[model samples]
Target: MPQKFALKQYLPNSSRLVYGCMGLGGNWQRLPLTDGDIKQAHAVVETALEAGMTLFDHADIYTHGNAEETFSHLFKQNPALRSKMVLQTKCSIRFADEQHVGRYDQSKSYILKAVDASLKRLGTEYIDILLLHRPDALMEPEEVALAFEQLLKSGKVRHFGVSNMHSGQIKLLSRALEVPLIVNQLELSLLKHDWVDAGTTFNDDQSKTNRVLGDTIEHCRLENIQLQAWGSMANGLYTGAKIDSNRFNDKQNAALLATKELVTNLANLYGVGKEAIVLAWLLRHPAKIQPVIGTVNLDRIKACAQALTLELTREQWYQLYVTARGQALP
Candidate 1:
């Protein structure tokens, strides 16, 4: 018999794994952006729903808001699919150039306008989940609270969260906001294990740049906030790099080969793909991490769905961690 699906209560009781759609409509140049591409993207959404994925993730800055438009077009084509799934989109972070060099805005005016435009682009009555794509250094807690209250009252958004923020940031926002901030999406993977190492200090300044693993995860669990992991594949940093590739170095290549071997072995044991095993490692954490996967390929979507079923043993989990870090527990 198939194993029962595990669901985490993101809010009071709503549960979803949250599929990231950053590559779907937003990064059209990298993926496809035409009307035909939009139609094909819808098929992936359908497949995800069929496989039990109920939450769709997006951001306004993604492909300069083209992702939301693509989703809107899909909703227009199949109006009924709206009721079957939860829609989540993010705001903040404006870009002046296509290279995405600009400012992060949390001003009430920009947020309000951004949400209105997002709703219009999504062709939806309400966004099930809304997140601040990134924190603004100039954000006023009271102003954010007021904006969230207004949106909640107007039925424009049902829930709120943040992306790429720390515990102190979440605390600051929670103090003035009445609505519960249900999630924090960040980068987490075996290769990026700082979330698990909490208070441990790394001497290498370069490694320290990205190391916040242990404290962030612990704080989220204590606060009843879900950890949504993006770049779960480390942006394919370890997939496979040619020896001459810029990203490929002796140390990095060794770690990648080790991870590839571990993932392949687990995939065979679980009857899934290596990618699924990679994702499963994140799910295996006690912090209740829900991976936000961005894929335009249907086979990849199916593989991701299968990942929900693969379970890694404790030894196997640590093996990958040790191999990636080239060190055992301290």
Candidate 2:
């Protein structure tokens, strides 16, 4: 096995599993951080480090910026940790206020200001990777390129990336930038399987139902751009997170239950926890898709880390896929 992940192209010592900071801090409220929130943050950071998750994912809007603020406490406690970990964050998402409706902003000014705020909140001098959280329909590639160049030269950001963007969008944006977009994060998991469906469901009836459609995985693979899976665990639907069954239809419910059963069986066989089996399914893919796990629960974090060493066979990987899809391949 190689010593580093595909992300190593950009983040040399990055982990296969990124510790998502979306769940950090107590709440999205503007209130000050309570002692309980600080305690939980410390615990999750320590557990993530022990699990070999040295790369932390953050967004400026996570918890209304409280997540990054809370994470800064970790570095304050141990300044050395700043050097030990690679911190990746995002911007370009602005929530609606009284005067303006919520929207995406990729303008040069917005990108620059957002990074400055993220740096201050993270208490870090430089961001390992800065991703545009989402694409703005009105984004100008030249404008974004200018912002990225300034960020790089100013020593505020080391590398750049994008989230929730398709290949064409990334390609178009990259054309104007001096930097190679190093990462592309998307919603990919057993529960939300369209990342794989783009290849399988084409020229067939199943194509119509694919909402988040794109050949992004293939494009990223070909370009050697790291593909990070957000919502990789399906909010724990398959691994036993309590969810209201009301949201799923009959077929969806059946598939969820069936996938859960198969994951459990495999977990016992692999001698690891169910979380590991679930994540192992993602890691089994050739894309080397890094799973950004956001579970703040200590045991769950440890369970997910087990996937670092677990490798699912081809058959097992397909079994989990079909079961989660709620239908067999065409």
Candidate 3:
């Protein structure tokens, strides 16, 4: 275990669970937003706020930029809601259309322009935190620092961070910036255990070689960068359409089934939703990771909020981990 980074010190009353706004804007490549979609967004946003989810996660490319567009409707309805929430959005992931190849763009101009677009769509004067959506292969750290400095000076963005970035990349960018990087968003869940597995198997041959998270979890702790996990529910392996997908191999399928069985038993024992157990698994980690759940269903949102109240013991936590991993620790 390492020193903890408390988010409240930075956000001043942020929630443990972040509501990922990816699902709010309806479908991708579809045009002409419908009234039902707007209504659903309102309902989901209201539900998350009621559940104490102050941090809303968004990306400029989410639903082709309509997630933020749809969420702006809430502020349009009640402007006061703006003061109650901490808004965070990401930029730099450009989709591949006929005109340009799909790639990352951390260039100063792109970052600056993207933030302005996000602010306009979100209908907010300032974004509480702005994150680079993913690591740009050609990123100029100094250029990125310039963008951060300009945004900070203009009072458009308060803090800066990165998503899907390793410690080396974060370090490079941090060196060029005056402000501290506060968050590192990554894909972590009961199903995605590589981050923990790397540490446990650090010096062993049985350790996975290619799946290393580059000491990211520990690095984040040492640097006091809060980790925010996306895809934290494992793409609904336990709660949604498990049988229909061909994404898993035989071994992975077996692990998934065993993990589901164990989660179900524990879920019943604790008298909480299955989602809570999934989220609780991450919350129990010393990192105090904030899981960004992408479901727009009100009931499911409330179920995830239950994780804040439930705590798993050390033995129970390891039991779930071993069950999900399909093997005992080496």
lDDT of each prediction vs. the true structure? Answer: 0.76, 0.90, 0.88
lDDT of 3: 0.88
Candidate 1 per-residue lDDT over residues 41-70, each given as its tens digit = 688788788767778888886776777878
**Candidate with better lDDT, 1 vs 2:** 2
- Candidate 2 C-alpha lDDT tens digits along 1-330: 743556887677888899999998878877787778878989999999998999999999998888999877878888999998999999999999999999999999999999999999999999999999998999999999999999999999999999999999989998999999999999989888987888888888988877455678888998888999999888998788986789998888888899999999999999999999989988989899999998999999999999978789999999999889988899
In order of lDDT, best first, we have 2, 3, 1
lDDT of 3 by residue, 1-330 (tens): 222346766887678899999997879975766788789988998999999888999999988988999868889998998998999999999988899999999999999999999999999999999999999999999999999999999999999889999999999999999999999999998888888888877777758563458678889988989899999988778765455448877877888888888888888988988899999999999998999999987888998988887899999899888888876788
Q: What TM value does model 3 have?
A: 0.96
Better of 2 and 3 by TM-score: 2
Report clashes for each candidate as comma-separated counts.
Answer: 5, 0, 0
How would you order the candidates by TM-score, starting with the best?
2, 3, 1
Misplaced by over 4 Å in model 2 are: 2-4
Q: For model 2, give the 10-residue run with minimal summed lDDT.
A: 1-10
- Each prediction's Cα RMSD? 3.4, 1.2, 2.1
Best by lDDT: 2
